[model samples]
Target: MSEIERLDLLEKTLGRILVAIGAADAKVAQLFAISTGMLGFEATIIAEIHSFSCFTFLFLALSALPLLFSLFSLFMVLYPRLDGPESVIYFYKIARKDIDCYLKQVGGITNSELMDDYARQSHRNAEIASAKFAWLRKANMSLFFATIPWLIVVLIGYAAV
Candidate 1:
């Protein structure tokens, strides 16, 4: 491929990685909202079951533990980790420079250097996106498991009332 075509390919790959990261972030936000709502829901249910029998309490604990774990996993997904080797394409690295310096450095880079930057950014971002997705999976699974015990707790709560 010509140098120009190779550059275009690298740009496309980087764009795809960035889009994947954006989707992962959006998923994390949605999961966060669900976790928040679940926490509020559990609080109300726990309050209603104030006179909890041992079974009720047991199920509540089971329900709560997984929910908390899911929330923690969601937090892991949202946590930012921007540390990496310096590159023109890495947001933090770029942001660390003053406007003139950033403009000069990016502007001064040759086609080959620009390709290197894009490739490094693509790899780094792919790693980040992969980790976020793994966390998202864990969060999703924990949330699902939480509902199972939570259902039992809710049913018992209703029976008690």
Candidate 2:
């Protein structure tokens, strides 16, 4: 097929992948929310039964919900850039020599320049995507570390009561 056709196919495939990633992310977020909510309810019940301060349970619940949500949001924001469109664009540029040659042979000057510009844009997009991915990773790691303390607090409270 022609270069244009190939690029079009790539774009379509990238779009589908992005949509699928989005759907998966949404499902994960929903499940995380539900689990966190259930855990909060259980903790609340335990605290009430033990006659401990309900504020402890409330604090745990309040913190857990937002932490889980933030993780989901981080994944959503980074997934597309890291694994979807930006990745595809990066690959496309790697194979761009063939595309440029093909366009030149076909006497497609305007199309050629457009593709060149797209490749450049893709490079910039990939860089930004990489930075975002790094940020998300750091955030995730921080959340993981934070969870340890939260879990310990809950466990201690439970053991005491």
Number of the predicted model whose lDDT against the real structure is largest: 1
Off by over 4 Å in 2: 1-109
**Once model 1 is optimally superposed onto the true structure by TM-score, how far is the C-alpha of residue 91 displaced, in angstroms?**
2.6
How close to the true structure is residue 25 of candidate 1, measured as C-alpha lDDT? 78
Q: Against the hidden true structure, what lDDT does model 1 obtain?
A: 0.84
lDDT of 1 by residue, 1-161 (tens): 99999999999998999898888878877777887787777777777775767887788888888788888888888789788778987879988999999999988999999888888888888898899899889989988988878888778767656
Q: Tell me how far the alpha carbon of residue 44 in candidate 1 is from the true structure, in angstroms, after superposition.
A: 1.4
lDDT of 2 by residue, 46-140 (tens): 56445545666565655465566556555655454423232213555345447666546446446655565455554555455455555455545
lDDT of prediction 2: 0.53
Which pairs of residues have clashing backbones in candidate 1? none
For model 1, what is the error of residue 15's alpha carbon versus the real structure, in angstroms, after optimal superposition?
0.7
Native-to-model Cα distance after best TM-score fit, residue 74 in candidate 1, in Å = 1.5
Model 1 poorest ten-residue lDDT run: 43-52
Clashing pairs in 2: none
